[model samples]
Target: MTGHVVWHGRRVAFRRGESLASALMAAGVHNLGQAATGQARGVFCGIGQCQNCLVRVGDRLTEACLLICEDGLIADPDAGGRDG
Candidate 1:
């Protein structure tokens, strides 16, 4: 099954049970965060152990790889003006 999700104010398509990070990457969104040295970051570890693939879901910080893609799921890649 598939669902509609929004990322960075843009609509994206995702399949059920899929991670938001995968959906974002499939949509050509690899730059999920910026490093202090101005480096782009995405998924380093597919599991939730790593905090590299962090994104904002509402007001909470969550790991994109651990978050299941769902309909109407809203996420901000650069939330809190981090890495931007």
Candidate 2:
């Protein structure tokens, strides 16, 4: 079995070792993270290049495009939360 992601308290399907961005997309989440524009903002530059797809992994923040998904992970959006 892959894994599951908690989006806004909603349990979503995900695969282990897969990037958060891909998982979000599989879950039909376009707005990976909120941007200066609004909640409908998303970006490219996958991997560890850009910090566009930022999300909260547990108590820490991480790039959704790069960080690999794990089983039972609580992920949340955080575009306005951190600038890193």
Candidate 3:
């Protein structure tokens, strides 16, 4: 469960049992977060209040903190400020 997720064609380590948000941050994607107001954010309220670290999992919107990543999880990191 340790392959990689392409970031701008750059292969980034993808842990099978880690949070996508955490992985993205580790991969230097901490500033890539889409907020409801169309602003930048990233797990502001790590507990889940801000809804900042939202991402897509197989076409479904799921919280990075609430979801455990798995192998082959094609994570489309949402940078800038846009909805997933």
Best model number under TM-score: 1
The residue ranges of model 1 lying beyond 4 angstroms of the native Cα positions read 79-84
lDDT of 2 by residue, 1-84 (tens): 476878768777876677778888887887866776665444478766777777777678788887777777788777666553
TM-score of 1: 0.85
TM-score winner between 1 and 2, please give it. 1
**Mind giving the per-residue lDDT tens digits that candidate 3 earns over 1-84?**
476655334466767776767777788887645555667766767665667776655555667776665655665556434444
Could you say which candidate leads in lDDT?
1
What TM-score fits each model?
A: 0.85, 0.78, 0.66
Q: Candidate 2's error at 16, in angstroms?
A: 3.5
Residue pairs with backbone atoms closer than 3 Å in model 1 (clashes): none
Per-model lDDT: 0.83, 0.74, 0.63
At residue 74, give the lDDT of candidate 3.
65
List all candidate RMSDs to the true structure: 2.1, 3.0, 3.3
Order the candidate numbers by lDDT, best to worst: 1, 2, 3
Candidate 2 TM-score, C-alpha based: 0.78
Query: Can you tell me which runs of candidate 3 are displaced by over 4 Å?
Result: 6-10, 77-84
State the lDDT of candidate 1 residue by residue for 1-84, as single tens digits.
498799988999998888999998899889887655666778998898878888888877888999999899999875335543
